[model samples]
Target: TGDLLPPLVHLGAAAPSGLVRIPNSNPGTPETLLATSFNMHQVTRHKLTLAGASFRVATTPLLTCDDVDFHPTDILVDADGSLLVLDTGGWYKLCCPTSHLWKPDILGGIYRISRKGAPLIEDPRGQELAWRHVPVEELLRRLADPRPAVRHRAADQLVSQSQRTEEWLDDNFATRPPAVRLQLVWILTRVGSDNAVTCLRSLLEDDEPEIVTAALKGLSLLRDRGCLEAARKLLQHPDGAVRRNAAELCGRTADRSAIPDLLAALTRTSDRWEQHALTYALIEIADVSALKQNLTHQSASVRASVAWALQSVAPDQLQAETVLPWLTSETPLLQQTAQLLTAQRQDWETPLADWLQRQLAGGGSVSSSLLAVVQHFGQSEHVQRVVLAAAASDTLAASARAALIRGLGKSGRHPIPQDLTDTVVSLLETSHPELLQALLDWLRASERSAAFNRRIWPKLLAIAQDDHYSATIRLQALALGGEERPVLPKPLFEFVLEHLDAEQSVPEQLAAVAALREGTVSPLQRR
Candidate 1:
């Protein structure tokens, strides 16, 4: 057993467990010794240690326990002098007790440690073969190697010599096993040559679903128009995954011609996830005629998809006859979709405002959906009604009120109505931080208007000087006050200077500086 208390060992102690000597063929080179240190959690090599440990030939470990818990059990020196280390992945204690115990078939691994830059003495497993000079046949054979590292190395070598490798794969693709064929398709994509598209297309007709899917993925990477056509045919493939993959490939290629195929898939597919994929693909292609045709489809999902997709399409082309019907659709998704589309058009502003006013006057429960229309299209007259409703409605959500406040700020460039100004000033006493912040933002945006500055500035100055409010609200109030030129009393100026020298946070100090700069003296004069 290796030493257990490695934490107390002197720094750089080998704590060597499985030590093996590598025979040197050339006497001129120093003798090489390989050992695993359980304490250091790595396999290291050294030159012949006679008294103390031999001077380190290399400081970096030959192999590190980066992934697995490598409690190396034993080390073997092959007849050819290559090193093999047996790692007993001590992961049982690391897993939950209720989980399945470690299976040796999956957990056991053998790591090969071979010296590079020099040939191994009489190696038989082709260990000494240079990757660049390796025959295409030899590299292809290595694709089926039991170890992933070997397979990856073989693939990398094949990719480097891609022209020759592509020719070889095209010549013998049918004779290879399905497993090997899959690997070939993967490597061809990495080769990224004109030949890859041709090869990937042939595999699209393979009997296996996995092979077809792999081919589709490979073709998507090429982004050729021919690949887009191939993917279009797979939209109706029997396998759902194949269809989904095809839809995604069409989206990535962005071929507008695929819109009809995507819409056809959207009609027949009941799967929610598949429908989402097709919808996203349609959105990316954005063919206005194709999307408009799907608006009246019986599936609420399809109608909703059309609604979402239309947001990106130019608004000028959307006729009222095509868009207005979806606004009254029973489905919430369609209703929201219609609202967003309606909000983007300036011509629809009057009609949308009229609808909002009717809903409010009828004492209807103003849905956030309805409020959104007002927020986007409302002007001065509309803002007066919404502000009054918001101030009067106790059942209104804070978020809805905040949205309305923001909408009022954006309503018009002219002076705000006195009633709306009074309503906003009254909200400063509100306890809800979100509502208060929204009110402050609105006040700041409207501060340039003389009427707004005269009405709101005094209320802001009082809130900033009040110590009972939290520092965050006070800072917001101070910032809002700085947006206008309100005459401050001497005590207010002295009050701002006091905070600059006190044990205040940086934000509070910044707010104090802004207040002095606007209310008392100019910042340029102070500098």
Candidate 2:
């Protein structure tokens, strides 16, 4: 192994060790051998004789690593007589420094070596085939070649020789194998000429559903608005796959004119996947009114899909009259779906707030759904109601409280009322990490007046210096204090500096540094 040891020991040595004979059927050719040379980064080929083996330093290496750290390990001669050289690569120096143990680089790959004119006995599925000089007719025949490489190359070249090949493809369209015809349709799309669109349109009427689907895909790829009429016709096709592909293509076309056809298709199929495909197409076309019509669908699943589709397009179109009825549905899925849709719509604020007020007044426990409604669309008035619910309901779930806190934070888009601030500040005494984090987030997001900052700064300063609370909560408190200018008092400034100088975890030190920087205090100035 140490036969070719380099003089500098620390840099490592080339350990050329394992050897294997290459099996050859030709008696006339000299016997060949392969071996690994680690540090030199080459698979050293040799000539084998009955007496001994001699190294053959050919102009081209059997395999070589361009990168300096590659370590060649072993060699295998496949049945096809191709050499498969395994590279261990650099592991210890690059990855596992402490262990100093040899391990192969996870990213390393095998190197294949074969002599000129060597017949590859393995499956020729992806093997490269020459196609340049082959006649257009000959290339068409190669489309049926078992190897994908041959088929793909032939299709590419045939499309490049466009005029004659297109005519031949059109003439032989009915007589050719379905697979070959499909490949032709794909080729035409790549050609993307006006004639290709005509060819794809014709294939849309083919008897084979698979061929029609492929043709639809090709037409969609062309993305020509002219193809929209043909795609719209397939929406009525008996085959679900064809209709699905056609609907998807119409969406990709993004023609508002396809809205009526997409809506008509939605009424025909109860198939969830098909309905989903149609709903998405309608959404892409931005037909808000048509989508709102489907909100009244008899099937809850369909209504849910329509609701989800509406979530993206027209949240304003989501009426409380339509969605409130869904919340009362027997199905949980529908109820949850309605809640999500309501949460995303800003216009639902007044109605949803009224519903929550009624629910709380009736002595109902706060639900996450109510909180979601407020979180997304809550006003300052809605924020006060949520704070009252949180205070009154001692039995409130942690998740519900968290949701309420998030809603309160989101409501800070408007000026926070003094009552809301006092309510939030009193919760800090609970020292609950989630609530504290939520309060910090709310303070950061809120537009605090100078007076509000002056009032909150001392309370936040106590949280920042306290060791009883988690580093995360304390860091958040520090971050909240940093948001307003001139809020960091002189005492808090020295406390932050001391914390930065103290031996602390990476996160704690980072928090202290950030707080100091945001307060316009530089650590370098102290030096």
Candidate 3:
């Protein structure tokens, strides 16, 4: 029964039996192969050979059984010719670990061998084909045979051929049907020779989409310098698929000059697939200038892609500020683009603040996206300046105040500047109590002098006394002062002390007390 030891060979499922057959009969032994489950996990099985027939021993010296890179395609023969081991490439080939493996243009290859002196026939069910010793050249000749069987065998054999067959491929390209031509393109790419490069380049002007697709696939596989150049030029090809493929190829090339072509492709195309592919390619290049330039593209889709692309290119350059005003643009697409740009490059905060000021004057509402962008610029002096400016505005000013307070609190740079304190104090006097609390958090976060907080403390306390003070603001004010309400100017401090004793809800009274206490504790003291 052909050295039968194990009754079944597991394909997808687990092999439970620990015994297998070994070919080649060794002297004094029946010559059986043993398959032992390596661990209880049942995922890996170890193979052992029988020599004199007492027990099994691993034949490989100085290495653990696990050191081997086992695959189903590999066949191991024992020294005594007693064992024939088979590891099919099916698992490895299907899972495709080597698919992305880095191999030089020429050294890597996969081949099929047929020992029957004829090519291996495909399994009728269309699952897989394997055999012993069939040369790829023999298969190529059969591709032109009059018989359909001869052609199918030849076509299938090309699947495992090395990428070095580009010259042979070019010579044969004209005779093959469009379908086989496409297959040849794929085969030639794996060959990765200069001839393959030329073939793909020639296909750039092809009228058929399949031909162009094959060429693109070949170029992508070759990925040589010439391929990169050809792909860059293809960005402007009359066909959309060519243009789209060119963008995709550029992403793989990672060449900087490809950036301009990718950007052009992004702007010139309106089809969503082309736009999406081009956007990703541009982002992969990490080209900041290209992103900024497209911020003004005529298509809203292109404009949106510009925003997505900016995240890939860090806005480290000085010119990023030039695009800051787009953050306040009425067009949502441009506004989204500007927001992402500002978030990455804090250096743009200065110009972004300026833009917001202009927008406020133009009667624009502080959109959430703009607020998010400003907050991401982080709590720097520039950000603080904008926050304070926003706090000082009358309409749509609450959003700005909220952004400033958040920036100051989370910015790791607690204690806003004394100048900021001066602005906050002035705004509190005329603004709603809600606005005052927002300013107070920023004031407390800033490590300003006692003198700075002291100067503003009186004004904040007086706001606490106004019966109109909401419970939330009243509590914030009390926290600022505490039990030992310090004496201050009669108008502000006296107002606070009276309010602290006023009959109110506990939360409101506490707020007044807190504000009184905060007045004494300088930002530095609180820290």
Cα RMSD, each candidate: 17.6, 16.2, 17.3
**Global lDDT of each candidate:** 0.65, 0.66, 0.55
Model 1: lDDT of residue 346: 61
- How many residue pairs clash per model? 0, 0, 45
Candidate 3 C-alpha lDDT tens digits along 346-451: 6666676676565555433556655555555546676667666766766555655665556556555454566776676777786554556666665545566666
For model 1, residues 170-189, the per-residue Cα lDDT tens digits are 58476776767778778888
Better of 1 and 2 by TM-score: 2
Tens-place lDDT per residue, model 2, 1-527, is 00122221122355664567765422224557677776677776666432101112332256776776666768986545566877666563433332255555544568787788865545454344554577787887888875555666777788778876656645646677777777877888888877778878888878777678778888887776777888899899877778888988998888888877876776677665567677777777776776787777776666776676776777667678778656546677677676666655566666766666665554435565566555654554664555545643555655556556677677546566665656655666555667677666666676666667656776876887788887656766776654463545666666666667657777778777767666444454455
Give per-model TM-scores: 0.47, 0.49, 0.50
For model 1 the local lDDT of residue 450 reads 57
Better of 1 and 3 by TM-score: 3
Candidate 1 has which clashing residue pairs, if any? none
Best by lDDT: 2
- Which should have the higher lDDT, number 1 or number 2? 2
